[model samples]
Target chain A: MADSRAPDPTRRSERSRRAIYAAALALVTEVGYARTTVEAIAARAGVGKQTIYRWWPSKGAVLLEAFLDLADQAARAADGGAGLHGIPDTGDLAADLRLVLRATVDEMNDPAFDLPSRALAAEGIVDAELGAEFARKLLEPQLQLYVKRLRAGQEAGDVRRDIDVRVALELLVGPLAHRWLMRTLPLTHAYADAVADLALYGLAPRP
Target chain B: MADSRAPDPTRRSERSRRAIYAAALALVTEVGYARTTVEAIAARAGVGKQTIYRWWPSKGAVLLEAFLDLADQAARAADGGAGLHGIPDTGDLAADLRLVLRATVDEMNDPAFDLPSRALAAEGIVDAELGAEFARKLLEPQLQLYVKRLRAGQEAGDVRRDIDVRVALELLVGPLAHRWLMRTLPLTHAYADAVADLALYGLAPRP
Candidate 1:
């Protein structure tokens, strides 16, 4: 596999792609999504508009790719040298969830991620096609990481067998999303821990 | 208290106000929040823009009031000869939550409520100040009812004493909100019941 790839043209193209992604994200965040144009992004990235058009069909497509790149960078940064996409399965589900959620708390609080995310999320809420595209491309993939972790727990006999992994993951994720979107309260380590505990043990007393 | 109220003019003003609210909701649903104007609403209602201004401060204010009225109507309709806003206790927290959530599913699915509400929600997502105001005035009050019910559960020992009522309510509300906002899957009675079960009992098997 390593010998099958040549680095010359690919490396140069990768650098250009990174610049374009950076420019797209910055422009959308700086100005609103409605105001962002292809020419503007190309100008910011020092690329021709034809180059952007050649790569992506529309401004939304550019923004979607930009978000995907941003999320990947965030995931790598968050891996903390583990290079894992999900909570570490240390044979302790609760502890693993807490560790991941604490990191998520930190991430959600980061200004670099939060501002542009909020702007994009706000626009997505109004635009159905955009929102659906975001879900398919960015949000669903991140959520699938949770689904994988939950399935692992289920197989390990930690999670209940009857539970739907998809919906069950929502119990773990939904509260945090709601808090972040609504700005109802501060998203903190304490809050994350509480959500994890509640999600694990539930509100009802164990029989 | 009932006998000391003002007479016919107050009643007439109330009617016009209701008409104006209806008009505003219809216009927003049809034209979307951005294109929706006070002039359009007034024209739709067969009233003057000055009349709308005399009573309300801005288009956001008008939309807010319109939503409040719509919610009241929904609540009254759902109440169905019962008291408004309290989830049925029946000494069963899970069942009560499921019942309330099912009603919410119905309300969310209702075309009359869904269209305008979605329009407003879409606009609110993009507009921070407006979103905050709407959440504070309309959404928060509705959520507080859940808080009160949950606190009652705590007092009755049905709910855990340690769980934050505010956050715990999100465990109940968040999944539903996520499903509605994202359209990730079908929102059904069975789904609502499952969420309540998971929220109350958690994903982990009982030890």
Candidate 2:
């Protein structure tokens, strides 16, 4: 018979994993990506290096997973614990995109997401391998939600059938990313709405 | 009287300036922005460290000037020495934009611009001060060119007067920058044309 006071091995491991992720995110935010080493993360996490090595192959892998987890938490919070099912679709493509982009602006403004995400993004810019992995693992999945919605829109006769949904999505995403990354202008709800409207209706005057 | 065979002091100064620019770009590419120092740039440039101190206040300042010169060189080469007056105004907004964006795709493909620019961009992402400085100094000027062109477009009835040209330009620029920065896909001439087309025409089926 197990002792009532004994710490469960499964629960302990889960706590260690969460600790490792917190350490990774905190270290990356404080010192940036290149300087946030496995040794530092393990030390900060109060876990043995072997434990981290057993779960993740490299620091990049750890940070990627950490970021994914953070995004999941934010999504869950936003969707009332539903998780990131997909962007909401209410048949109006313009309204739906505006709603989503507004939420994106809110996320970009959040320091919890902003600082660590910037650190990872900074590294990904110079490190092509990491950048590609990030785009594939993190960005591409989120982008696919837009693709799914646009495909649905095509079926509903909202989006033009000839439009390449993939490239079309970039019109909205690119401006936001550019504004956010470059820090050229304030990333605001109004800006998001303008981007959605411009991308949907275009710069040319409606006939 | 000046020695007849001796190098002109002005010409010698110009050569030294060019050499400094080359070294700054090269060092940053080889060692990255964080590690690239003014002393190292001077050593690589074959000049005294005092010479660098006499010019730029910081390494960031030196890199900024160097990148500006590199962009000027690329532009002059493209326009056959006409210099970067502005984006070409052929009156046909679509064709003009297509031609310019295609050239941009070619520029992004150039390794000379690719390597060093990536280093600076990586640093900018996490370092908000540097990011803001680079944007104000380098990016905003280039963007202003688009603002000018779009203003002309509005007058010619190619673009809507109500459209915010500042944000409108991002639809073309954001996608290219996102693709180039993230290396998400093969940025091609065809892709540039698609971005331009989708931007000019509303995504919704035209009535």
Candidate 3:
């Protein structure tokens, strides 16, 4: 009888998915990953538990997808439709990096992003399987963007050809990650720009 | 009573203190910070729960002090009586940094150090209060060693006078921390040496 009165299953599924993502993020932020449960998420999301289970194999998977969705939304908002894919290639590598880093500072500071991200990141630190999954699914792809840009710079002769782009990207991003995660200093655009300059120009006095 | 029979209370207290620290480290590594309890630590140390409470205010305090003790032990073991209290003043800053970083690689890879340290670090990532305590108690003092060395270099006309020693030190340590925490690559002595060289010499070709 319920199947006969079809009210667009696809739309209903999409709605359920968004609600589940919201519930999952909120639960993790509030109670932390150790305590957050799929059943609780489904209850808060006002959907059947089987609905969430159908889409994600576990709570970790749900959270990961939720974060990806949030990132996508934030990226779209920042670029007005450019989305969260790669840094813009504006010919000048330093300027491009600066722009991206500035955006990153904003994202990192955003409460919508900050609270849930910290919860997930903190969970990942302790759970080796979860941490590896998070790194593989989320972090590595974003890092690949830097690899692509650095390769472009290498071809352009802006970066040294002998340098490993992977390691070099760490120099660019590591300090910011350290500061952001540890809250050692203010995560500001100026700070990001300064990091970019130091990494690009080298700390030694130009001969 | 055994408490009244002590020839030297200070010596007896020191033994108990060491036992508590050892128990804290082992408990955290096995059960993690969330499940680790003062009672558990006390039990494992073969001391009363009241003994732990009398000496330390909280589980976090006990863990922090234990970690500090562990770090001091590792440093003393690495540098003998001199300890890792100061960066070596070998006149050549790059070479000195390389020597310390190589030791760090060894320390980070050691299981006795790595397991408990990772557990503590993982807890700190999510627990802001604990993380701040770790920085204030442990990481900052270690970092100041680099600051002193950089200041010496500035006096020697090797480092630029205008550079912020704190930020500059990050340029050297941040990349290494990133690689180690993320498990992106093998953290080797060669890798450490390269980080020191690149940070000191810069990525650009020397003119």
Candidate 4:
């Protein structure tokens, strides 16, 4: 039976999707990946389990799309809805990098992102198939944004022409991830700025 | 009653300990940390379950010690028995760092170390207390060796004194771990050399 007073079907579907994504993230964060299930996600989202199954084949698929949505939200939030056109290229490589990394440091500190991300990363590390999928779908694309920024720098003569930008980018990102994951030291904007400084100095053209 | 026919008690205990360490590592490698048990470790080692219980408080403790022992063996192998005196500090800081990083690349490639290590690291990431202990006892000391080498480089005028060596060391080690853990790219000696080269250039004295 068609209901004339009902909300738009497309709009209703979109709302349900957002609820499911939020529910999935919260469930994974609170209970961890092993314990999180589609049934629980559906229950928490206040949506029928059939709705989730119709859209996604498995819990992993649902979670992946949920993360994608979260990242999209973070990206939008970070840049005032510039829509992840890639990292800010203000033409000052060092300052631009520092700003982005500082934002990253803040995001890492946010429990909303941190706990769920750790749970996924831990599972990803043990599950090779999931690890590869994670890298391919999520990590590599984000890293490629750095590549774009570096390439832009290279053309502008700010970064060394002779250096491998791929390898060079790691100096900027690797240390931050290491600090965050290993808990070897406090992660802060100061550290992010230092990394940007060190890596930029390293990436400078030969004397 | 003491068994006179037994090989000296101290030697027997040492043998048992070595066997237990090997078994613990192997079991964890094969079955993962969650499935690994004291009884299983004891059975695999051909020692009584009480032996593992007597020496270690938990499976995590046993795995930790097993990892420690493996690291000792790796260190011995890396340096030909001069002991874990830290990274080699040849006068040429760049070459010395490259040598050690290359060795690290090899170790990361070795399945004997890689599989069990991945299992523990996976668990550690989700388990904060265990992660802290692993870092404090295992990871931080190894990183300090980089600090030692960098400090030596600083004194020798090869590295800039103004730089934070602790932060600088991450430039050397972090990229490797990131690539290894994320499987974003191949882990290789060439990558190690590139990291060493870029980081060294970054640590250079200002013009």
Among all candidates shown, the one with the greatest lDDT: 2
Clashes of 3: 0
Against the true structure, candidate 4 reaches a TM-score of 0.91
Model 1, position B96, has a per-residue lDDT of 91
Over B150-176, each residue of candidate 4 has an lDDT whose tens digit, in order, gives: 888878888777788888888889899
* TM-scores of the models, in the order given: 0.89, 0.94, 0.90, 0.91
Q: Taking the tens digit of each residue's C-alpha lDDT, what string does model 2 give over A88-132?
A: 889889999998888777778888888898888888888888899
Location of the lowest summed lDDT over 10 successive residues in candidate 1 chain A: A75-84
Q: Candidate 1: which stretches are off by over 4 Å?
A: A1-11, A79-84, B1-8, B30-35, B78-84
Best by DockQ: 2
Where does model 3 exceed 4 Å of error? A1-8, A78-81, B1-8, B78-81, B205-207
Chain B alone vs. reference chain B, TM-score for every model:
0.91, 0.94, 0.92, 0.90
Off by over 4 Å in 2: A1-8, A78-82, B1-6
Model-by-model lDDT, in order?
A: 0.81, 0.88, 0.82, 0.83
Q: For each predicted model, how many residue pairs clash, with residues at least 3 apart or on different chains? A: 0, 0, 0, 0
lDDT of 3 at B184: 63
Best by TM-score: 2
Total backbone clashes of candidate 1, pairs 3 or more residues apart or in separate chains: 0
Q: Report how far residue A101 has shifted in candidate 4, in Å.
A: 1.0
Lowest lDDT 10-residue stretch of candidate 1 chain B? B76-85
lDDT of 3 at B159: 77
In model 2, state the lDDT of residue A59.
91
